[model samples]
Target chain A: MEIISFASAVAGLGILGIIFGTGLAYASVKFAVEEDPKKIEIDEALPGANCGACGFAGCSSYAEAVAKGEEGIDSCPVGGEELIEKIADIMGVAASSSDEKKTAKVLCQGGNQETFNKAEYQGVPSCQAASMVDNFKSCQYGCLGFGDCAAVCDFDAIVMNDNGLPEIDPDKCAECGVCVTECPRSLIEIVSSNEDVITNCKSALKGKEVKVVCEKGCFGCTICAKKCPVDAIEMEDNLPVVDTEGCIGCGVCVKNCPTDAFVEVDF
Target chain B: MQELFLLFMAASITNNFVLMQFLGICPFLGVSKEVPTAFSMGLATTFVMVTSAVVTWLVETVILVPLGIEYLQYIAFILVISSFVQLTELFVKKVSPPLYKALGIFLPLITTNCAILGLALLISMEGYGFIQSAVFGLGAGVGFTIAIVLMAGIRERLEFADVPKPLKGAPITLLVAGIMALAFTGLAM
Candidate 1:
């Protein structure tokens, strides 16, 4: 009786399995979705970082959008030129020549010694929260040193130095712009990684006013502008802007800045 | 009619799958971060639950009870639930690409949700009729949706709140879930 019952149990389960398995096999083919083959190809060509640099949620979504002709071919900043070319080939379109390799550059040089705090902030150690209150630091436009940029970076590119300033590693940075957006004072900028000249200060305060707040503050003295041999520096809104296109990357401006506001980024 | 109502009530509220019974806490916590995503997860789980209930009931009545192989119910129920989830996933993918993208990995995750297997087991154990089992499954899904969506709403608000440092993130989420569980217990009275 036991042997017969066990055999029946096995037979019943096997029949049930076979029925469901066939049903599923048929359903899979019947319900198969036709997807663009180019989307998968383009997705493979992408860096798959899912950094949201292209305003899409991830590389796959961006690939789907590109495959559908909804987004431009060169939308991904981290993909650089090669991946863009590969994606363009998959999409059968001419790749744009405007793709530039960029890196996040911290525009502030003021650290613990160069900058002083007006009040000791004891609340959440976020730059956004710290900057909400007035006079957290004497300098209104300097790195708050709360490491908000470091916190937002998924690539581990930004690190808080011992001097309470974010130091961005150019090699590790994907140029996704998360740190650039996270800075409360807008002290980080995405610049051409090949370009060496960067204005290390973002202070809009005039010469004497900047000296009182932070020692390394750009005083808008126009000294770097005057010293530029290629006429690459221009004073805009009391700040010297480096014309990266014209700038020959000579260290002349770096030497001429009295407050050391102009800096030459090392590759 | 009364029996059906009581079954629905028991599945949905008095024995709620998420808050009261705590059967499928993985997706309840994982997908409950966003309201829309949580709602989608709830709907997908509901669809799977009801379908599993019907199919399992059929299997129990037609195969298991007649053969007196009631002991094979657990393994059979799992096999049926997983296969059904797979089939539903394929159907959804074919019908709506946008939904397929939005649901992402959570759709396949419904296979492992113990709440589904528990529902199938419960229906068989109670000797519920086909319609009653279906209603119970639907009620359980609705109950799960309500709990998860409510949790999502609270978590969204908590984003702006100045929660204490030690009790931030998962700690605070768990505390809220515990409090919600306590409040749900009030429904029993």
Candidate 2:
């Protein structure tokens, strides 16, 4: 009885398998969708970061969009120049000339010793939550040292230094702009990696007002603006904005700043 | 007609495959993160369930019973359901790429869902007629959809809520699902 039942089971399952297998084979041919072959190639070329830096959900979807000619070859910011060139080659399109690489620069130099707090913020350690209360710190426009930007960075490029300030490593940075958006004080900016002259402060408060709270705060002294020989520095709202096009990487502004707010970044 | 209505009510509400019987809990938690995606997943599962029900019923009554191979029901049902899911996936992909993308991995996952197999076995055990079995499958699928979509809605709101640190992610989600199961028990009455 056992052997007969086993044989019948095997026969029943075999017949079922053959029927379903043929059905699936017929369905596959009948339901075949025409997919672009270039999509797979472009997907392979992508970095697969799924960083959403290009406003797409993931690398595969971005590849599909690019393959469909909906998005340009330069849409991916994390892939950099080499990936773009490879994708262009796959698509048989001329790659655009490489743009200057940009990296995140921390504008605030106010570390633990340089800045003072008004009251202890014992709530959630988020910068957004801390910024909502006016009494968290004395300087309203400086780094909160809460590491909000560092938390949002997927590249592991931003780290809180020993002094409780985020220091971005340019080499590790992808310039995806997540850190830039996460900063409540807007103290992180994406700047040309090759540009040596950078204002290390983002404060627009006058010199006297800044000196009361943070020692490292930009006093908006206008010394850098006055000393610029090419008139590259313009004072707007008590802050010196440097025009990269006009500035020739001269150290005049760096030496002339009263508060040493102008910093010279190497590489 | 009355019997069919009762069967639908029993399968959908009084004895929901997800909330009541606790079948297919994987997709219940996994795909219930978003409403639109949850709805799509539910729809895909529904399509598979209904089709698998009809196909498996025909196989059991016509081939398995006559050949006295009733012991092979489990393997035969799995084989029928999985292939049905595969065929449905290909058809949905070709017809609507957006829906196919929305369904994503959950479409293929319907093959392994115990709810489909359970429905088939329950119908055969209960000796439901052809139309009655089809209705039961449809009702069970609808029950799964309602449960998942409601769970998704609750979870979407939970995102903005200031939930406590200890009960933040999955713990809170499971707690919410338990509460929803409690609430669904009211439907039984």
Number of the top candidate by DockQ?
Answer: 1
lDDT of 1: 0.83
For A1-267, candidate 1 gives per-residue lDDT tens digits of 999799979988998889889989999889976678998799889886444445454466678889998888887778899987898789876543464557789998889888898888888889999888886688888888989999899779889999999998887887879888888789999888577688888888888889998988889989889989999999997898888889898889998889878888665
Clashing pairs in 2: none
Q: Residue A103 error for model 1, in Å?
A: 3.9
In terms of docking quality, model 1 is acceptable
Tell me how candidate 2 scores on lDDT: 0.82
Report the Cα lDDT for residue A41, model 1. 90
lDDT of 1 at B167: 93
TM-scores vs. true structure, each candidate: 0.70, 0.68
Regions of candidate 1 where Cα sits further than 4 Å from its true position: A35-102, A108-174, A179-187, A202-253, B96-106, B164-169
Off by over 4 Å in 2: A1-10, A35-103, A109-174, A181-186, A202-258, B98-106, B186-189
Q: Per-residue lDDT for A216-255 in model 2, tens only?
A: 7778888898899999999887788888889888889998
Q: DockQ, in order, for the candidates?
A: 0.28, 0.27
What C-alpha lDDT, on a 0 to 100 scale, does residue A43 get in candidate 2?
82
Error of 1 at A259 (Å): 2.5
